[model samples]
Target: MNFHVTNHTLYVGKIETLGVASSSILQIGDTQCISLYSMFDTPPESVIVGPVAPLSPPEGAESAEGEDDRNGDAEPESSDV
Candidate 1:
């Protein structure tokens, strides 16, 4: 397994002779982790992990005040509402 450290957390992904192959995300609060595995019939290889940009809030969301004219971000926070 290989580890990639980001500004916020770490990530684990698969690597190959060509480069990184596939990756699955694992997160704990703001941290991240991933594990790499090899098949019994396959030979061991080096895996590279890289950083990724953090995601941003959805677009059209209100800054803070509730003044959405289009109601784009007016959805209820919970089903009880």
Candidate 2:
């Protein structure tokens, strides 16, 4: 955003592109911070959500088509266990 300060008041904004910011600069109270901006060469392609690719399926390796995720065994715990 372009900040126009005439007596600490905004007057005009000349934004060309309209999209979410991957990064930004912020001033909060007495602290100042800057964010890193990044973008992909092309936006990701969309996928069809139909019976073939049903929504809310099990994630990760168990998500293969026609695979049975439940193997009649309790899930394994990580190091925290």
Candidate 3:
């Protein structure tokens, strides 16, 4: 099983249906879609049994933003100035 989130689109492969819900209780189509955040809160006991490659950020650690000045060891400004 593999799960991936790219460009705000989540892809879940190799799913197994535990049980079917009552159609009278709630309206459901042929396929069911669950939010990733909801699944993130609590995962199933024993589902998803497979190895998948780890995903990396689309952009590497190459930010154009300037570095923070406070990170340096420069001394603080004097009150005399």
Candidate 4:
């Protein structure tokens, strides 16, 4: 198959799909990548598959808002100068 190359990137070809989701094998440099093409810009709320691997968080969840939760909840107290 002849791949179209442009701007240091190669457009291999369009991949056919039965669902809304589609994918293609793009040759970006030396790597042959499997790129997923989705009609939705972002993912759905929750994706369920198999016995595990839920992509979304559970319901009624709070956003971290850029806060780090790695060490658990903590508060900064006023230090004596």
Candidate 5:
């Protein structure tokens, strides 16, 4: 396999999520050679699928429900005459 790319331009503003599943390949640029091999011992029935749970926020990080409280807890500034 051979690839000749010239004057290639790629602009990305935002990427929310990118997922690469098992036995997959993600190539962005030109490559001279690529070899991939995957071996699995588990049978087809061994695979388990369940609901995807939402990840909890990190410690001290505000939760989505508490976004409105961000500016509500500021103490009032006192004026000195």
Candidate 6:
């Protein structure tokens, strides 16, 4: 197999998010040759369908109750000069 590419130009201003999933390719420039292969076998019985639970807080993170203090909800202490 033989391949050839010439005079390729690409311009981008902004990209918010870009995701490349399994067996996916994102090419931005010219290339001489490329090859890719992927295989997937999924059984219907092995898949689970259910409501997604809320994500748990990360380790060593402050609890929701403590977040209020940091968010400046409490009134500041008045000091008399």
Q: Identify the candidate with maximal lDDT.
A: 6
Whose TM-score is higher: candidate 3's or candidate 5's?
Answer: 5
Best by TM-score: 6
Report residue 71 deviation for candidate 4 (angstroms): 18
lDDT of 2 by residue, 18-54 (tens): 5555565433234445548787565444445456653
Off by over 4 Å in 1: 1-17, 21-31, 40-81
TM-score of 3: 0.18
- Writing each residue's lDDT as its tens digit, candidate 1 over 2-44 gives 9876675557596335454445333345544557765544435
For model 4, name the residue pairs that clash: none
Badly placed stretches (over 4 Å) of model 3 are 1-7, 24-81
Better of 1 and 4 by TM-score: 1
Candidate 4 lowest-lDDT run of ten: 20-29
Per-residue error at 11 for model 6, in Å? 2.3
Off by over 4 Å in 2: 1-21, 28-35, 40-44, 52-81
**Which pairs of residues have clashing backbones in candidate 3?**
none
Instruction: Report the lDDT tens digits of candidate 5 across residue range 1-81.
Output: 998767667876865648976677776666777777788688985655777554567777654354353577644464322
- Using all chains and alpha carbons, the TM-scores for the candidates as numbered come to 0.16, 0.21, 0.18, 0.15, 0.30, 0.35
How do the residues 12-56 of candidate 3 rate in per-residue lDDT, one tens digit apiece?
Answer: 676566664433223233435643322233459445566854434
Could you tell me how far off, in angstroms, the CA of residue 20 lies in candidate 4 after the best superposition?
Answer: 20
What is the Å distance of residue 41 in model 3 from its true position? 32
Arrange candidates by lDDT, highest first: which order?
A: 6, 5, 4, 2, 1, 3
Query: Model 4, which residues run further than 4 Å from truth?
Result: 1-28, 41-58, 63-81
lDDT of 6: 0.64
lDDT of 4 by residue, 12-36 (tens): 6876556542554433356654557
Instruction: Report, for every candidate in turn, its global Cα lDDT versus the true structure.
Output: 0.51, 0.52, 0.47, 0.54, 0.64, 0.64
- Pairs of residues clashing in candidate 5: none
Model 3 accuracy (lDDT, Cα): 0.47
